[model samples]
Target: MRKYSRKKKEIAVEDYVSGIKSGDRTMLARAITLVESHTNRHFTVAQQVIEQLGSVKTNSIRIGITGVPGAGKSTFIDSFGTYLCELGYRVAVLAVDPSSEVSKGSILGDKTRMERLSNNPRAFIRPSPSSGTLGGVNRKTRETIFLCEAAGFDIILIETVGVGQGEFVVRSMVDFFLLLVLTGAGDELQTMKKGIMELPDLVVVNKADGDNVSKAKQAMREYNTILHFLRPYTEGWTTKAVTASALEETGLIEIYKEIEQFIHMTRNNGIFEKRRTEQLKEWFDSSLKDKLYAQFFYDEKMKESLLQYEKLIIDGEKTVGNSVNELISLFLNKKE
Candidate 1:
């Protein structure tokens, strides 16, 4: 215990918070590492850091970027993040990579892919493993966002794994959700149309250079039409689709401008605050559900009973619904 105390003291949460407030990138990374740690021993320090972070108050513009596997999301974020840094905005990117279930660890290739951006002093890139969590956004991501904001990043970009369900989870956590699309016509557009079309605050047909420029433009038009039919997420904020060549850095500025316009419109109409309030409510509800589920499954007797119930179901002695009800009764009785 004394050795553990010494190591904890060596990290110094107050020093980390001070460095973060001054926009020190190293300190910011260290803070995130500490928060992401699985050890419960860090909880006290983590809470203290979170408390100090309250003063920072997250004025950052949170953006979620998602697309199918080949849609050039990493490249676009690398280019766009560089643009933001050049314009003097401190940026933090949280890229959620899918973890291999067997290994329970991420490939962590986003940093390698976005080499230049990863090296930027004004930018911090963290690649987090999805850990098979129900939501595309991991449990620790919300906390990490606050840490980034406290560290003075004015722009927070969350890049989700391109899987459709993950995209929706990412959308819920951001102020703006940008969907990257590739050049496609009838079949391809129809395939992507359902999962992503309704959620994106802005859609960009990426890889718009080379021979695909015309096709990309046509796809953008198709997406625009799709957007018209889906009800706008908030009144006075219209979703727009555009084309961009991340390789050539073309149309990136326009995307940023559109985001600014959307933010302005939403804030003026009070929808921005309302959305944030709703997001907080969702976070609270999700936390409650998670706690309840953990308690239900983690109780020693519940685990043993669940195994027994599974055996009974396999042997045809109990119906699945009745078994579940029995488990719930045991769970409730135990609580009582």
Candidate 2:
């Protein structure tokens, strides 16, 4: 019997760029993997690929979807994404799954739940692990979105891991933010994160079919009343609540229309361009901090010093504030 080597072939940076630009899904997926990787080699290659691609500025929309657990988010995305594909838009769903703290393992099972959209030719669904970054959102999600857009995805849907601070983080990146909710508004509102109510541009009361129709409508009304009192996240836009049934595929068109109207209004008011500029600046600042953090923590000397400092602190030989100052000075001196 002949033994076969199982090593995977490494793609060239040029190939990655060309493949992504030409809308090759395989290359796009691989490029996203490169960006998501923690290794130094992968980071260099990923940055080269991204820089080569440049700022695409494609005619695209980034929509952030977040909701409470059991709010039927996957179901809604499946229905809504398929609907968008039918309207001749290539949809890309980036579903961020929460990772286990101990094992750092993620289920990444959004594809399984979004059966229809997963199978659709015009739709692409990528499930990413939060990997303990950005509050249950994939750290490389912004880069992933750029790659997807270069691959001709006109509609990008970022589905965050439930409702939490992750929604706030995702809101900063997307053009529109949508909140999905179920009946029992009063109880849910009480349990939600403190500033979450002020984040969404639109709130949908889902599962509005058969027995739940009346309850969903009541919930919608309650949400609308609450929303009426709060300021809208976007200027000159009214954030309202509507009822929808993912199972029945009802009210999806209305949701789409609302989004369409929003994009139009924002563009006319110049708020769209302004927001994108601010987002790009924020991304730069965030990337710089991440790079500095990696450099300091991953440095051999720094790691050794950290261990010594940690031990000293645990032994009550060094104060935390003093240790931190010393570490920073040491790191800067090493760089010098």
Candidate 3:
């Protein structure tokens, strides 16, 4: 694997662009890794290659699917993603997994869960490590989406573990955000948080095909009533509550139809374009922070000074406010 990756990296930027455009999954995976790399050399090469390929110039439907653990998220993706492929659409599943503490690498277990989608030629599945980012998504996810679009994937599904409040970043990045809920968890009114209720483009109750059907319907009804009282996530459209059963493949079509209707309505009203623009702006701002932090954090002098101030705080020799001011002064006084 290491030799193959090294060889893939040696492929020139033009070749990388060509391979990505040709929809070669190996090349696509390697390109995504290059973008996720933190080294200066890899970063420069990735940027150059991305500029040449012009992933941002292409267009695709970006969908974010977030649900709590045990909500059958992977099963839902397998069923829904297969449905998408049957309609002759090229689909990509970017599954973000929690980072393992020891190696800081993802468990990469979603493939086992999404077996059918993984095997489907019409589908491309990539499981990425969250790398301990606050949200369950890594920073390069936006760039990956761009690459997937350029690689001929018309539909991009971003699957994230439900990190509760941390899901906002995923919400901001996608065209449609789907929140999957399971039945019999609890009373929706008591368990659902207001912020989550307002964030999803659509709230779907999964496992609706089993004996849980009645409970699922009840949850849907309860959510619809609760959602009536809150402001809509999108300006023109109210978020819809529905149910699904990934095991039986029931309601997947209905879920997709709702997704299409939302996209159509948002595109016609200009919300879709506006949302994409805002996400790019966010990416720009966040990248600025990373650049600034890299510059400051890598300086040996700054590191020593920060440690000294940190020690003072630990020993109660200085207040955190004073230490912050000292660090700010140290940073500003240094020559650019």
Candidate 4:
């Protein structure tokens, strides 16, 4: 009998870059998954692919949509993206779904609900599993944005997991942040809080059709009152409230106009490029911190030292602060 050995297939960086630049959706999807991977080789390949796509000039509209559960996020994206596609725009929707505890995967599966956009040749939708990442988004999402832009998509909509504090993370990466709110859903208190209200460039009262129309209008009024008290979330823009019915595809035009107005205002005032520059700087620092921490903590010798320090803390032999300092010193001094 012969023993069999299998080698992993090598990724060609130029091929991915060329394909993405040529607007090949398959290669774009592959590049996104490659960057999302945690392997060392894939990391190298991801870097190469991004580098080869340096300074892509596509001025795609990057927007982040966040809301509490049941705020009609998927339907909103489907309607908004379909509208954009009808206008001859190539749109990409990146929906971040909450992870399942058992499998650690996206539980809702955004595709099932985005049938209209999925069938549109002008649209591409990718659902990413948050996997309980601290920010409720994948760390590689910034990289994914670049890939989508390089693929010549004119519009990019990022739908966050909408589970606590994740809105802030998504806000940092997009030109406009839209907060979707439900009517008569006790969201007045949700919108009353200063932190959540400060994130949106626009606050939308979703499901504003039919019998809920009055409640949605009332919710819009309430949100407007709240916004009047809070300072503007972004420079050169005021957060406005509007009503929309994603299921009926009504009020989407207003949302689109708001986005266009934001982009125009920011671009004319030079804030658009400035914001993107700041986002890139923040991403670089965050990635550097992650890499350094991984290198220091994952070393075999350092891992053993960390376990020993953890035991000391568990046994109350050393304070957490003191143990952290000692562990840093151990790595700095290259001691096991």
* Best-fitting candidate, scored by lDDT: 2
Model 4: worst 10 consecutive residues (lDDT sum) = 130-139
Global Cα lDDT for candidate 2? 0.85
lDDT of 4 by residue, 1-336 (tens): 222354845547888889999999999998887776655556667878988899888778899998877788888888988999998999998865433433465623658789899999999988775454333134477888889999999888988756644577778889999998887535445544447878899999999988999989998888888788888988768888999999888888998898888899999998999998987887677667655765775578888988998999999999999998988887888744
Ranking by lDDT: 2, 4, 3, 1
Error of 1 at 269 (Å): 0.3
What lDDT is reached at residue 214 by model 4?
93
Writing each residue's lDDT as its tens digit, candidate 3 over 8-47 gives 3476788779999999998898888877776655666677
Q: Which portions of model 2 miss their true places by more than 4 Å? A: 1-6, 97-110, 130-139, 300-336
What ranking of all candidate models by TM-score puts the best one first? 2, 4, 3, 1
- All models, RMSD in angstroms: 4.3, 3.9, 4.2, 4.4
Query: What local lDDT score does residue 312 receive in model 2, on the 0 to 100 scale?
Result: 100
Tens digit of per-residue lDDT, candidate 2, span 1-336: 222454867888999999999899999999988887776667778878989999897889999998887899999999999999999999999865443334464433547899999999999888765464343134477778889998999999988755435687788889999999999999998878888989999999999999999999999999999999999999899999999999999999999999999999999999889988877887777667666777787788999999999999999999999999999999998853
lDDT for 75 (candidate 2): 94
After the best TM-score superposition of candidate 2, give how far the Cα of residue 326 lies from its true spot, in angstroms. Answer: 5.5
| Clash-forming residue pairs, model 4 | none
Candidates in order, TM-scores: namely: 0.80, 0.88, 0.82, 0.83
Return the TM-score for candidate 1, rounded to 2 decimals. Answer: 0.80
Task: In angstroms, give how far residue 248 of model 4 lies from its true place.
Answer: 1.5
Question: What digit string (tens of lDDT, one per residue) describes model 1 on residues 163-281?
Answer: 54567777778888898888774565556636567788888989999888899899999888878898766577788889999899999899989999999988888878888887677
Model 1, residue pairs in steric clash: none
**Which is the better candidate, 1 or 2, if ranked by TM-score?**
2
